[model samples]
Target: MTRSHALFILMLSTALPQMALAQAPEAQSGDADILVTGRAEKLYRATDTEIGRGSSDPLDIPQSVQVITSELIRDQGARDITDLYRNVAGISASQYATVTYRGFRQDGNFYDGMRGDPFQGFAVPSLFSIERVEFLKGPVGMLYGASAPGGMINYVTKKPQDEFAASLRGIVGNYDRYGGSGEITGPIDKDGVLTGRAGAFYEHVGTVQRNSDTSSLVLDGGLGVKIGPDTKMTVQLTRYEQDLAGRLRGIPIDEDGNFLADRTWNHLEPSDYMKLNGTVAQMRLDHKASDALSFNLSSRWFRYKEDQDYHEPRPVSDTDGDGVPDTVTREFRRQHRNIEGVTIAANMIAHVQTGPLRHTIAAGGDWYWQQSLFDGVSTRAGVPPLSLTNPVYGLVPVGGYDLSNGSVERSDTRSHRYGLYAQDQIDWGRFTLVGGVRQDWFDDADPVTNTAKTSGKRTSWRTGGIYKPMQRVSLYASYSQSFEPQDPSRQSASVGGPFAPVASRQVEIGAKGELLGGKLQPTIALYRIVRRGIVQVDPDLAPINGVDQMSPIGEVTSKGIELTLAADITRDWVLTANYAYNDARITDSAPGAAIDNSVGGRFPNAPDHQAGFWTRYQIPAIDAAFAFGGQYVSGQLARSGAHMKGFTVFDGSVTKGLGFADLMIRIENIFDKTYATSAFDARRGAFVGRARTVFAELRVNL
Candidate 1:
């Protein structure tokens, strides 16, 4: 065997004993259940989660809910949501800054259990102030209303603590990347009734793409007040900004899915840039009316603005005798957009009992509103064709063309949504039953035309049950429904009215168990989902002289099985593993559907098989930890007609503690694999994954 493989096996052997000891009952009961320690947390299992509502055990949820704890995020050196995909099953990042979960493209992301618009030109939120990320797979419409049938992601923000604590950290990585962050939390009053926390981070990073750089700043703060013995309130504020210079698009590829340009090639002018800025303010109130009853309310206001002047390169012709492209053109686009949104939600929870049954009931309602404005201009310009054998740079001037002469488009839209939902959980001996229902109302308007564009209403529901024959083992089955509203702008004029909301249904069965005397948690799930009523052009109408008609005639189905395991094994040993098999297909569609209908076409960016494994071992004698992990994704279609080859990537890290501080070094893409992370279109281009890189970080606690 190779030397590296032999070394890895040797290290695994040395860590086996610790893993065995952690599975013992005595070790499991010792400190494995402790929720948090200092700024870090033990990885294995979480006691409770806030995914469906206020609180519930993961085993009791009857569905797949994956939690990415802060401790794991720190160990992985994750910067944004995209960095956590390896820990989540059946999910992948796609082109256009989107994510595909299960088989569908996620429409939006949630913050602290509240819905938010992620397409408002803002980059993914920083993880500096986040406590954990929860991925709830399957239809959650009974509680969250309209959403993607595949699932939704919720980011839980950190709250103020009563105890005093402070920390500072600095990070430096290859490609001229550097950043610093700090946080402080403490009691603000002598009586300890008031607490506050603040954190900020700044980073300037160079991208693998040529002539591209990004700078970002994030600030978060929160204040908590104990108004009375039974009442408490908290307020939080977040501000973020990001600037991107040069270009940030993928490299073009040939029809055979081969890279046509260098990995770091750029076709953008020097003046091309994109900037995003946003701010959010939130308030929450919690009150205990009685020992068995409680109430909570939360409200948030957010605003984001973005400006962009960008250019795209498109292959035009091949002048040379060779088959490779020799000429390219550019498209310049300018955009200015602004968005304002608000949300208010409230819920009440009560613990009650009926004859021979114990019950936990929750009722809630939420209202949301948003307004957005978009102005854009675009033009196509020709550039001098450069030789493929040896390319030259800086041949085109920046912003040399007049933007006023380009084609212009503008839009102003406003929308409102409200939902009411109730859930009841009943327990009897070894059986638990859950039932929920929700009603949602939505409306949209065009202020510029002073007209109501569309209005709709939907009702969703869920039912599930869990049976626990053993203390640590639970089996569950659930059925759920969800809805998604189509944009009025996309509706054909011949349709006579806005298209109706699409609907989705899901059926899932799963088993959860704590094995090895509770030190290891394993979950297995199988699910099938169907979505219908997709809007498509009415081929029968044949676009009569270019005025097309539309109809709802598309359908899709996704079925999958997922298995995951998390183990603390021992005080100094941790491991996580997951695998998924997905079969997502376009079952039926009209002739004019957005995607081609081949009877059973696979979904883009959805791989049939994915798996990942991570493990860490700590040595007290050396005051250090060593960790390694790897991920694999099966080959899949990049777009309708193009295929992308699958690849495996490995990562490793080492950390050492120095009395008052900790230092860590991480190496990513250790093998320097050349792979596509995202794709524009089948024959157009694909985004390349980062090359082998190294990073170092130091953190001090005060």
Candidate 2:
């Protein structure tokens, strides 16, 4: 541990005991249920209202959605997307793990309905300028083209506020880590008609894995104008840069080939390194044509670049008699990737309200274009007979072929998508009905790297109903669909070797209710997803590990249940919890396949059980709050048949407000427990997991 990190932890521990003892009594119950314009809150009224960030009615969205609020982030001591996932049910993070919904891994991510996939392993979003994160479970292809059938995640950026407010915060944490964020939002003109907001944040973080660290900076700004009585316009831009210094860890399986023990902590030496840098920007406009009609349009552009190089130890051969094995060899590889994209969307909503009936209709269209280029170079040095004992580790640089040797390849791909969707919601007394349909056209064009192209059309629809059983009670159920064309980069045989496009579909049903004095909101959902024809290079033709190149040839099915609960049991106490159960299996297999897996066997890295919960208490007299929470995931199988046991982790945080400033402190892995987020290389017992850590901050708000 560095001297600075040691000191920070020491100071925090020294002050906590005394502060807690001197704090005033906790606030009474019922005070925390204040009605607020939260993102999740807006989702429920999707059909009737134009969603700027999120809807006013979250429940009526027809999908299993979970909102990670700004408050949850603060209370959980979260610093990044990885941290956020720790307490979000149904989500798991393994370096080799794929995005999953209902136990099935999905594709990348989305931001405000736009694509947010990282080409060369770089898709973590900064939370410093976020208001909330919405996790929409199930297929979202209808709304977001090329999305994974598993699900989609949307990050809600903070917007301009009507009130004048500014805050600055700084923190020092364990492992020589420190960071801070500053934010300002207010009206630029009187009458609160025009508002603006700007925020900046920076962080220097360290990991338990030696030589693994991250330094990041972000700047966000936005302007909102109330053009007229019913029209509004907003423009937003964000820039971010991050430096990563870390040893990438792969998956690890036991001798029998299952995920290793849940609590195992085995990290490799710091001999590998990877880093990335990128930026994203967006703009939006909203206008109300009349008292019953409104329109929205938004556009986004993103650019990313990364530099990566790593060392690989391989076997070497020795001819002469040397006491030391035979020969030493090493391999080095460097990859550079550039990705850019733009998206445009326009939507309109019309509402009709009368004595006994209320109706809202919405229709919209969206378009997106994304292009990416990847270049790589690999070099090897040492004696060649290739023996296991004569390994490659210590070696000097040597002359190696450049791109001409086919060791390096460059490829660019463009994916374009257009979609039209319509939805309607009708309300009659205490009953409400909602339904929607979407048509999408996806086009992928690539002429440079061999010949690769795919054109596909998909249609998805959804319907649901909500009934208010009583003044404080309600029931809701919904069904929805999703789809995705073949990945643009998938390889093929005719022009190249043998790979084709893959497609997927999904079905869902769910219900939610609020009871116990309008304080507790809970939901239960069940869904099934089907995927057919996944493209792959023929292991024999392309010889990817001696396997022939192949086209999409099999079908997989995944089904699961989800439950969530969020409530303020009392004024001083609030609790949030969620659980997910998944059953994913492969229903079909390719002929002459190398591996014959079972239909009921668990999917790779998809845990069958997942849950998370958080609770907080407010001490009003002292202006302080305390929170405790964590997540649990069941064990999952490694790709190579290894079983990784399930594990549970915990975290906590506390904040106190002074006259003009507030101090916030948080501890991660409170139990100092050791566990692996992911691992690979069954031959070696190396796993990657974070150790215990602490963070503290001082903030000034005006």
Q: On residues 184-203, what C-alpha lDDT tens digit does candidate 1 reach at each position?
A: 67677778799988777777
lDDT top scorer: 1
The TM-score values for the models, in the order shown, are 0.91, 0.82
Indicate which candidate wins on TM-score.
Answer: 1
Error of 2 at 144 (Å): 2.6
Write model 2 residue lDDT over 298-348, tens digit each, in one string.
887888887766544343334566633333234556777788888888888
lDDT of each: 0.77, 0.64
